[model samples]
Target: MAPVKKHGRRRASVSASELAQMGVCERLVVFEHRYGKRRTVEQQQAIKRGRRAHARFYREGHMDWTRWWRYFIVFLIFGRWLTLCVAKWFQVRKPHHET
Candidate 1:
C-alpha cells in the first residue's frame, strides 16, 4: 500500500455568515466544513431586492440643495419673521410703573 498523505493546517478566515453560524450553533461550522455553504436562490433574490430598495430610497430622498433654492429662501424668511416676533414680544413686555 502507498504511504498515507498528511494534510497541513488550513489558513483561518471567517466570513459574516460563518460568524452568524458560529453564534447559532457550533455544529453548523462542522456542517459547513463538510459541505460548502451556499445561499439559496430565494436568499440571493432577497439580497438583490434589498439592495435595489436601498438604492431607490437613497436616490429619491437625497437632498439637491441647488435645485431646492426656494427652501433656503423660505428658511431665511422664517428666521427674519421669528426675529421680528421676538422683538415685538420684548416691546410689549416693557416694564411700566403706576403711582
Candidate 2:
C-alpha cells in the first residue's frame, strides 16, 4: 500500500503592525507605499515653524521652543523616575549597617 502525502497551506506574509494599519484605513498603507507622504497645509506650516525655531536656536544659543516643551517636560519626568528606580535598586542591594 502507498502512503498519501499531506500538503500544508501557506499563510500570507503580513506583519501585525501592517495589518493594524490596514484595519485603520485600507488605502493608507497602499498610498504611502505607492506615492510616499502627502503633507497637508497645516503640516507644512508646522514644519516651517520647526525649521525657524531650529535656526533661531542655532543663532541665539537657546531654543525658541514650541509644542516640544511638552516633550522636554515628559523626558525630564521619565529621567527622574528612572533615576529613582535605579537609586532604589542600589539601596535595596546595599547591605544595611547595624547600630
Candidate 3:
C-alpha cells in the first residue's frame, strides 16, 4: 500500500508592481499575494503617509483633512473661498445635453 501526502496552498500569479506596492520585505511576492497576509495600517500609513495629505486641497474636488489648517478658526474659511475661486477660474464648462 502507498501512503498519502498532504499539500499546502498553491501560489498565485503576482506581479512585481503589486509586490512593490505591498512593500514586500523578504523575497515573497507571490506567496504573500496568494496567502492571507497584509501590511499593518501604521506601516502603510508611514510608507505613504503625509505625502499627499494636502494633495486633496491642492488638486481640488477631493478634500481630505484640509492640509491648510494653519488657522482652523478663520483662515480655512477664507482659504476655502480663495480655493473655490481659483478652481472656478480653471473650471471647464461641460456642455449640457438636451436629449
lDDT of 3 by residue, 1-99 (tens): 011225754345544555575584544645554564577999678657555765645667434345444447578789899999988876755556834
Alpha carbon RMSD to native, model 2: 17.7
- Give the worst 10-residue stretch by lDDT in candidate 1: 1-10
**Over the stretch 1-99, how does candidate 2's per-residue lDDT look in tens digits?**
111235643344655655797789867877776666677999889879988997987866544454468789999999999999999998888566854
Residue pairs with backbone atoms closer than 3 Å in model 2 (clashes): none
Q: Candidate 1's residue-wise lDDT over 1-99, tens digit each? A: 111236754546655655787888977677766675667999889879988998988776665644478788988999999999999999888577833
How close to the true structure is residue 57 of candidate 2, measured as C-alpha lDDT?
74
Which pairs of residues collide in candidate 1? none
| Off by more than 4 A, model 1 | 1-22, 26-37, 64-70, 73-99
Please name the candidate that would achieve the greatest lDDT relative to the true structure. Answer: 1
Instruction: Give the CA lDDT, 0 to 100, for residue 28 in model 2.
Output: 84
Error of 1 at 84 (Å): 12
TM-scores, each model vs. reference: 0.37, 0.30, 0.25
Candidate 2, lDDT over the whole model = 0.72
**True lDDT of residue 18, candidate 3:** 57
